[model samples]
Target: MFELRHVSKRHGAIIALDAIDLSIAAGQTTALIGPSGAGKSSILRMLIGLEWPDAGEVRFDGVPLRRETLLEQRRRIGYVIQEGGLFPHLTGASNAALLARTLGWETSRIEARLRELAELCQLPFAALSRYPAELSGGQRQRVGLIRALMLDPAVLLLDEPLGALDPIVRHDLQTQMRELFALLNKTVVLVTHDVAEAVWLGDTLVLLRAGKILQKGGIDELLDVPADPFVHQFMNAQRRLREDA
Candidate 1:
């Protein structure tokens, strides 16, 4: 499990994150939803050790995050971002196997892992030979996901993973992602602005605003019993739209 205890971050005079406290369970998918500059990405970054907190600590499996343990912790966490974060010059297979090679995994083992992840992600075998430029947006994102999962990380952090794809592709990838996460049983933290996406993909939804947690719980819990007017309005808008449709 991942725990954030009174975690706060500041940049000069700007407070990027307030005294935030949250717990993320293993093998569950949690979506962080909010408007822009709400610090959703900041949370993800802190988890991956990209950004250090000015106060408090981020703990994984009861161990506090520290420089001495950063590398090992990172190796156990997978991160995906917009644009897939693939190397344009490398083939999909090379990209996926990069970490394995760096970790001194055997050639045969790397190939086997690539094949397994490709199958699990439902990516075509042909895509392994293709460069990022030659693949579609969805395909690139799939490769990016495969790269992250290549090591079978315990936790996956996704920052707007579907933001760059077209609607059709986004929907398809979303479905695939949910199924993949379920099968893998890896803890997932997804950051997105799309309300519907959050509802669809998350086992639990965390709403944030201005570096603070507004609400966090199951979708049904929030919908049926909102904490305040903002949540009430947000839930009602979806409910009314669905009712009208």
Candidate 2:
């Protein structure tokens, strides 16, 4: 569904991504996993056209991603960031329906879609009336998910959507997220620092370091055949974190 070929990006003196080539399959979930400065989030930013690469190209559904085509391409992509990225003043329902409303969708249609998403994401009907400030962390993330899925986009790009929640909430949402991905069957690219989350949620995992891809494959493949010592250290760091926990 998406492809990045020899992509690179830089911010002043800092290189965010370098010579990164990756592909995301249609109707499958892929995870970009790494520590800080690994360029995981940069990949999402490029995919959403928030930032452009200094070299190479980004393609969506076989078309080049350019400014002229970005608006139309974004319509088919759903994106969610940490803490929901919700507007502070808007009610959850209103936030979810903002795009649809802007697109001139009828109120009846918007309401119907909200109802469907509320059920699909297991969000409380009562909570939809609350603003972002009025909801718990978990609730806010669910509202974000609802907003992203509101348009029934063909691709889902989530950057640390569960990163801020408490453990219980993160665990609950992880299970729901897995189910949602399978149920929707949309191409999904998730950026996360959590190894277990990446392994559990992604059909394919791309491990990155220093703005470059270290390895990309299934969980077992990564564990069994690390590309370099950095890969081993990165994977073991997660294990140590769990052990410490």
Candidate 3:
């Protein structure tokens, strides 16, 4: 549903992304993985129209990304970033209903949707009245996810959404996230440095490095036929690492 064609972005002499081309299909999850400075976040930024490419184009459903249609297109996609990014003062329900309020949804409709989302995300009804400061890291992340999914966007972009949680909470959220995505059938593009996370959440994986794509394919394809030694090593290490005790 989204396509990036030969896109490149630069900051003076530094290249943030280099000739990157990617496509995210409907009702599928694609993960972007690599070391830091690999242009993973840059790709998300471009997709969300937060950053424009210096060359080439980013298109959503065949339409070139434009300022006029950006808000409409964005409303059709959900995004969650690292650290939850919730307003410190807004209650969880308020946060989740932000978009709905903007769209002129009635107070009752917003309340009902908030309740439904809380249930879907396995959060307590009481959480609706709590602020970010009152919740644990995991709770905050779940609230963030619910906020993004409130409008039931066709596409979801998650940029290291689980990074700030504790290990156990992270693992639990990972499973919950997978189940939620499958149930919703949303087109998902997730950015994570963790190779295991990429494999677990993505039907297809793209390994990036130095602002360029190193390889992209299904999990089995990449594991069985790595593009180079770097990919081979990455896959092997991920396979061998044991869960933290």
Candidate 4:
């Protein structure tokens, strides 16, 4: 559903992504994984039109992503960033309904959608009246997911959505999200630093470092035949984490 072809991005003299190419298919989940400054989030920025590539192209469906079509494209893409990105003043329901209301959806329609999402995410309907500060970390992320899915967008881009939660909570949400993805059948692209988390949520994993893709495949492929010493090291680190878990 999305493609980045030979994409490059730079900030002044520093490169954020260098000739990175990725393709996300419909009804599948792909994870971008790496260490800090690996340009994992840069891919999402370009995909969402938040940042432009210095060279190459980013396409949604079959059309090139440009400023002219960005707004329209974004309406069809659901984005959930770290910590929910909720407005503290707004209640969970308000936050979730923000986009739909802005788009002129009826109040009844919004409430009905919220109800469905509340059940889908296993969040309480009563919690929708609470503010972000009042909700637990996991609850806030659920609120964020509800907000992102409010419009029923065709593509979901999640950037470290479960990064701040406790391990138990993160694990629970991961299971829920796995089921949700299969249920929704939407194209999903997730950016995360945790290899375990990536493996839990993604069908395809892309390992990156120094702003370039090092390897892209299943977890077993990465473990079986690493591209280089760095890939081997990276997979080993995650294996240790898995063992500890």
lDDT of 1 by residue, 114-204 (tens): 8888899889978989999999999899899999998989999999999999999998998999889888888999999887888778888
lDDT of 4 by residue, 65-149 (tens): 9999899999999999888999999999999999899999988998999999999999999999999999999999999999999
How are the candidates ranked when ordered by lDDT, highest leading?
Answer: 4, 2, 1, 3
In candidate 1, what residue range of length 10 has the lowest lDDT sum? 236-245
Pitting candidate 2 against candidate 3, the one with the higher lDDT is 2
Report lDDT per candidate.
Answer: 0.88, 0.91, 0.87, 0.92
Error of 1 at 206 (Å): 0.5
What is the alpha-carbon lDDT for the whole of candidate 1? Answer: 0.88
177: Cα error in model 1, Å: 0.9
Residue-level lDDT of model 2, residues 180-220, one tens digit each, is 99999999999998888887788999998889999998877
After superposition, which runs of candidate 3 have C-alpha atoms over 4 Å from their true positions? 241-245
> What is the number of residue pairs that collide in model 1?
0
Task: Supply the global lDDT for candidate 3.
Answer: 0.87
lDDT for model 2, on a 0 to 1 scale?
Answer: 0.91
TM-score of 3: 0.95
The number of the candidate with the highest lDDT is 4
List model 3 lDDT by residue over 114-213, tens digit each. Answer: 8888888999979879999999898898889898998989999999999888899999988999899899998999999877877778888898888999
